[model samples]
Target: MTIQTVAKQLTRTTKYRLNNGHHIPVAGFGVYLLPPAETFDLVYEALLQGYRHIDSAVIYGNQKEAAQAIAQFVKDHENVSREDIWFTTKIWNVDHGYDETKKAVEKIALEVKESIEYVDLILVHSPLTNKEKRLGTWKALSEFNHNPNNGVLQVRSIGVSNYGKKHIEEILAIDGPVVVPAINQLELHPWLPRTELREYLTKKGIVIEAYSPLTQGRHLNDPELLELEHKYKIPKAEILLKWSYLQGFVVLAKTSKKERIKLNFEVLPEGQGTNDPLQEGSNLGKIDLDPNILDALDKPDSHLVFTWGGADPTEYED
Candidate 1:
């Protein structure tokens, strides 16, 4: 991203203030490639550098490390309370439905060390909730929010991920989900901007969190990206990260390095904000995409991909 302001602007450090009263850091190190052994160290490094939010899910399988890092952070710093940490966990796709949803969330919360305190947020991991049991699953989450004991059900803000418009609408119509999902974690990057969905969500007051903000490191070689990297004197990756963030989206960036994590958090120069690589470039790629789990992550090479749902609102297109 390239931007211009006369006075010295604040560091590129940014956050997305969501509708549900939670502010998410626009940038933080990602952990998709991180093995369990390295997870804690990277997470500790992130928290020490002022990352308040950490996004993890059952599928990621690094929750234990992520949790340990947070607990250790609190022990290491009296000033850093658990309450100060905004931890996010998601229910997996296979866990969709009434009783399974209940058990899944319960297991995840407990896996993270059950606390009789407020949970930052919980998202329905995927949009593929069985049609017959979708409402019950959501209702189960709603109960989790209102439960007096706050056990496996300590979720505060409930939402969805990887859902498209039709799926979103279906969930929102369900009976009594008093809690509005505050976020829609989607696969967004300049090369594949979800323009239509972003516009819709902004109107609905749902914050969009961009996963794979760097496009899984696939766009770094593009000439347009290279040009911006040169123009801003930042790494092409930084240019991409800063662009997604500066454009007002909460970005979840993952890394397993102290230096790269620090480098990723560096402030971007001006003009990085207003420019859109996809907007003005005859790029190397096109936006025919699916919700792809990167090939290197032990998944099959070819799989149909789509968007994930978020905090449970409908009409989420793009």
Candidate 2:
């Protein structure tokens, strides 16, 4: 199936309702590889520039700074509160077992509790651990969901990252009532579409969150993307983001620049009459891509096109 077949009419205020009834912003600002020292400032810039979602992780080593920025953003904006923004973090791979997961979560909760009241979502960072450990991690997160008061940290929802169909099936096959994951974030981009897995995820009602949507600026120069860049009169990065959004996937874009952050969030309709991509507008629109163009970009085996940092954990089996 074509990626944009299930595309929703999106606006700057558009959010996808999860299975748990929680709403996640269509666009999120990712904080991967951001320096701890500069994370607060950059994250604050993103929030100020109209990014309502901030995606961070325990392994990123800057969750504290990201939390501080969110806290400060809330305090400074009179109309905005904690609930106005979405904050997502993850448990590291080492914290996969039941006991270790509980302790790790409690520790992260304690660390960020002073900055923010609760996290919007917490994900199992990867599926590289053994099946037992993976289920244990989910169990720990499930318990936290069922009983938020059990610890200092409170998470509104739980999910998995880099999980394939088999991995998700394990979670679903758990012995008793389990909180089905609300999200399954993956290293998705034009090069690595993962179409089959996406179809399975859609059937199961799990939202696909696209990370590294731009291929970390590595494939922006592709002939087709560049042609589209010229045709749409926008950067290839925005073109890729629109592609992900059109596919009904929550897209996370990371950049340290303020203008780029604004560009990534404030996508305008065709006749907005503003050549300046940084100009703010409420009506968000999609980049018009023909079906053939979308098909051309769907290279399933291109997962090896680039390595952001680590291997694709979705391929890992233990």
Candidate 3:
């Protein structure tokens, strides 16, 4: 099907309700490569720029900064409460066992200076670790969902990142009742659309989070993307962001620049007024790309994973 045929309305207030009943904002600010020292300020700036979702990880070593920013932002904005923001973090590969994973979550809560209830989501960073360890980690996350002792909810939902179909199947086949993953964050762009994995997750009702949506700014100048940029009069980055939005995936855009942070949230068509792209009736809500352009962009070409290479779970299969 052509992209326009499937494209849906896009708004800054757009959200995807998880199977668990919690809602996640469609557009999130990801703090992947930001220095830990700069994370607090950058994240706080994004929050001020109308971003309510913040993606961080233990491996990224900026969970504390993100947490601090969230707390500070909520304090500053009277209308905004802790529940208004969605915070997501991941368990590092080193802490993959049941007890270790539990402790890891506790550490995150402590570092963030918020109770478990404040943390919206936690994910297994990847499936690169051994199978036993991976399952054990998931078990710990499941326990938190069931028992929130001392008024600490631990985490509202659990998910995985960079997991292929095999990894998901293994989790579903665990020996006993286990909490199904609610989301899977992956490096997705037109070049590496990962159509197979996307379809598999769609059938299972697992939400997909698109990371590195801009391909690390490498393909911004591509002739095809440039054409769309010119046609829509929007920046190449917005075109990429809109593509993922059109496909119904939560997109994570990372940038430290204040102006870019604000621009990233503005996806409305030209002349719609820049004050608020999320305003109703903005043409930016829907995108219509040519069928041939969609095919060229969505077709899998040479593998181009910018963040995690040689870490695909399928590659570990015997």
- On TM-score, the candidate that comes out on top is 2
Summarize candidate 3's per-residue lDDT along 38-128 as a digit string, tens digits: 9999999999988889999998888888888988888889999888899999998899989889788778877874621467888999887
Q: What is the lDDT of residue 224 in candidate 3?
A: 78
Local distance difference test, each candidate: 0.62, 0.80, 0.77
lDDT of 1 by residue, 1-318 (tens): 122211122233334456656555555455665788888988999888767678888888987678888888888999878877777878787887889888887677666764324466777866654556665667788788767476445666777776665666666676754566678887776655666766776666777777887767655676666665565465667666656654456678777768777666653331222112112322222111111211111112322222232232233232
Give candidate 3's whole-model lDDT.
0.77
**Over the stretch 37-155, how does candidate 2's per-residue lDDT look in tens digits?**
99999999999877788999999999999999999999999999888799999999899999999898888877688999898999999898799999999998988887778755788
Rate residue 73 of model 3 by lDDT.
88
lDDT (Cα) of model 2 = 0.80
| Cα RMSD of predicted structure 1 | 9.2
Q: Give candidates' CA RMSD values in order.
A: 9.2, 5.2, 4.6
lDDT at position 134, candidate 1: 60
Give per-model TM-scores.
0.77, 0.89, 0.88
